[model samples]
Target chain A: MLGVTLSRWTMSYFAAALAALLAGEVLMTAGYGFPSAPLRAPETLVVVHVVAIGWLSLLMCGALFQFVPVLIARPLHSNTLPLPALVLLLAGLGALLAGFLQLAGTLDPAPPLLPVAAMLLAGGFALALYDLARTLWPAQPLPLPARFVAVALFFLATTVTLGMLFSFALTTGLGSRPLLAVAGAGLPLHVVAGLGGWLTLAAIGVSYRLLAMFMLAPELEGTRSRAVFWTGTAGLALTVLGGVAALSLDAALAPALIGGSVLGVVALVLYGADIVHLYRARKRRIIELNSQMAVFAFAALAAAAALAVTLIVLGRLSEQVGALVFLIAFGWLTGLGLAKLYKIVAFLTWLECYGPALGRVATPRVQDLVVEARARTWFLLYYLAVASATVALLMAHVLAFRLAAGAMTLATLAIAAELIRARRLVDVSAEIRLPAGAQRPHLLMSVPHPSP
Target chain B: MTQDYLDLDVRPILRDGGEPFEKIMEAVAALAPDQGLRLYATFKPIPLFQVLGRQGFGYAAREIGGGDWEVLFSRADIPAETAPAATPASATPSAAGASDWPAPVQEMDNRELEPPEPMVRILAAIEEMRPGEVLSALLCREPMFLLPELEKRGHAWRGGFEPDGETYKITVRVGETGDKA
Candidate 1:
């Protein structure tokens, strides 16, 4: 009953984004950063954008395109926005990554391309936000999903604006301000908005409908989901605003800044609790590969949050290590998203083709799409690679970190392959179709009918 | 005669509807037989069952699958002493009019102005009506699929079921001027 239609294009954008990152990984492996690279290396920016814009952003946008309508029980205001959004974002992201790569080695004329690309990416995102907003306009008194979407929009705006500002500031050498004077000044804000607001909030909203609908669990009721929403939202807002102010040396507001973080922690905890509750009530005994593997991302967030809080309290939050947290959140959430998309695409394909023939003719079961057990192995390895990378970066083991990054790249490539297979890209329907003389049995029939 | 019963598969008989069920019911009555001929279908049209049962075709149903059911109907007056033939043993058969059978419960309840108690009363009213049967106070919410389901079942409601504040009520008048019935 939903009218979102951007999955195919979004997956393509996702694929392109991963390809760019894998290319960057190759560059880094070839002694590109051999001479004690700065913590905020340009190559790092390339990897960051690949994970952020390429994987997580693409996954989030595609999923929202497919899912938001179902959450609101309404269709998108217009179906045409996704195509342009996909094209503009992918092109802009490609340009921006190339600019970052060029800057990493030696400043080139391509530096000017950064702002241009950022503007295009921002414009694309703005259009998406507009389309989504208009569609959600008549949603009648706003549900919890709408609330989450609203917050995610705000974060999207902030992240894009901050990203653009950073892009411009990189060229102008606005090194007077302490935070701006630092190499990776706006990293924390970008991380907070992109990870906590955009990815986390959107994922939560999407999960509410998806998990319940597929598992046949009852609709979420009471104030718990709402509480999680408000807490996460308010916490992130405080954390972002406070961190920004503190960076600007607003020492008076530092306590409020800390308070905001504490609230964010509370929100994450509440969100974690809600997820557990959702799983408990689920009717589907077996959670498919996506959700089972996705829990690590959630765990990583909670764990990273605790570590961040400790570092903040101790007054020793390192910029480089904070970057690592960004990696974990982006990698894990995006990885889970890409993994889940494999199943969703397969399922939607089945529904589109076979659903009408349900009682009229025999159809394959949903399980026939892919072997879940094998997919589960890839997911486990992906998470393991992420954990190792996070630990290696924290300990400042440069060689181990690069090795772990390669493993991560390989794992992600495997995930992409699995998604391609799940979509049945190589499989023909004719191969699986029943022969002409075969008797097709009803799925709901208790007795299996013998072939006539 | 018993061999005749063994040779007949009851599937086509009940699938043939009223006349066939009646003929089978008649044969059961003449049998002084062991068991009744049971008619089973996924949909249990209550009127058909009531007609056959009242006319001496005994039937019982047990749900076998989520929405599938098995119905068993046997002769009502089979001898207490005789172990009825595993197959039909009737030598002679009579005809059962079975025409006085009440219409389907849905048809009987069409006369109500307000929601009727026991609800099935609404069906009774509809069945009794010559042309217009009023079915009132049947709750229908989010009726897109439901209205179509009713239509597919040959039920027509003018302006369909509407809610009375929190609860819904409707009058479904079968055999209206345009109705096929």
Candidate 2:
């Protein structure tokens, strides 16, 4: 087995992503966004961008930098490119947030930051997409996981391009009629492409491989996995088509959206079935805590889909859109991200600190790095708070939602602390750390020294 | 033409993490001139082929279910036609062109194992091997995650799915710098 080399900038990306997540959660708890402000208000846009680009996008990119190699059994196109991409993304996000503040009149006479942010973000995403594409190109007949990532990258390009168009239209004030129409009606399309296609699809793909590897289950490259990919792709395509139609004020948008939603639901059902199969067929009798906790995230996905369908059937979807998005963003995506990070942080730490010494020394198992008992409480609390928040949003209970958000922030902080402990080798036995060859890795960055 | 044989089962010793090399050697020394040795172990005793090959033995190996392998080592000087019962078509050393790549120093049945474990075992085994030594492994799937790591560590490998199209067989040659750890 070839070893998975440490992606030098992955931790930094994770660090920035976590900070963004905390910022979003804190903002919500403080009543800065959404229900307190109108959905399309500048304040709401700031919170949305902070979470969408700053947190989820960064997390996905970071994971891809490390796992894409494992997926295709190839190294990244350039190890040196990731740091610059991160910097560009962060800078772009900062400018975008400030630009939103300027639009809200919170900042006086700020430079027209929208177009500048747009260029920076486009450049950043371009570098990332190019690096990933080149790495994926030579691996012909890619495995199922790599194929998912490839499609996801395509959507990411769509997402970034659409975003840039919106930014330019907002800043330049010389947009074409169609372009202005897109900016007016394309927000849903942007969210669908970014959240559903780029982020969720990539998460599904990576999770398939990671769960199988962690659970000792057989890889799911069968008909079910193929169905998941095709259906998911087709669903996204139809949704994007609907988005385009909406931009043109065409009557076909409604049917296309409905059809796409149905297909997307079908894909989710198949994916859920595949996950059950994986868990049932796993060879490891006693599964780890991370895998166990991920069930909550899966359940959230199912619940969110079910809620959306019910809302549509009851003709209340427009009113409850906020609740649905909240469930999807926090309950599904963020929940899964947090659960996986619990394991990935420890796994990468072990690889960085002990991978070279593997087979030569008595290094600790990956499970030995974290106190799951302590983290378990935090994970449970986090999910409960998300659930509460979703219900409160549906009931339009602003205070209740804020309270739930505060609990979520606290839970996230506790889980993050546990991750930091794992990184610092706090839970690893003293004997394992005190050995002659054991080196305590730097907290947030990998040292460039060659393997001992 | 039928030779007497000595039987040895080192599965328990291997399972207990004990080295069975000295015991295997003692059995070899005690073998009668007209006798061969029949070895039964949990995995194919690949390194032992060269060890016994040096002592003038040509071996025939066959999987005997449940990850166990039976290898019969007979004197190579005996003509193949005369030792039909013991010399199967897969007999090592007697097969032309196959002898260039030395018998693997370590053989692993990673077919039942999961990901990372197979990678872990193979990497650990290679780390213990001397430079230029070869190790063989049978896996349930293509060793995708392990191959790049091998290349990273300067080891060389060749692999393909077996006739069954399910089992993947790989042979890795440890590089000069592979054993640096």
* Model number with the top DockQ: 2
lDDT of 1 by residue, A57-135 (tens): 8767766765666566566666667778877888888888877866865557643788888888998898888887887
> Which ten residues in a row are the worst by lDDT in model 1 chain A?
A443-452
Q: Whole-model lDDT, candidate 2? A: 0.83
Docking model 2 quality class: acceptable
**lDDT string, candidate 2, A234-353, tens digits:** 999889866776667734457767888999999999999999999999877777888989999999999999998999999999888989988989988999999999999998887677
lDDT of 2 by residue, B1-181 (tens): 5777899998899777556777988999998887898898887776566556656788888899999988888884443222222232235432122345665656667776645567777877787677887777788777765676677678888777677766778888789776464
* Fnat per candidate: 0.00, 0.57
Quantify all predictions' global Cα lDDT against the true fold: 0.57, 0.83
Q: Alpha-carbon error at B88 in model 1, in Å?
A: 35
Isolated chain B TM-score per model? 0.31, 0.51
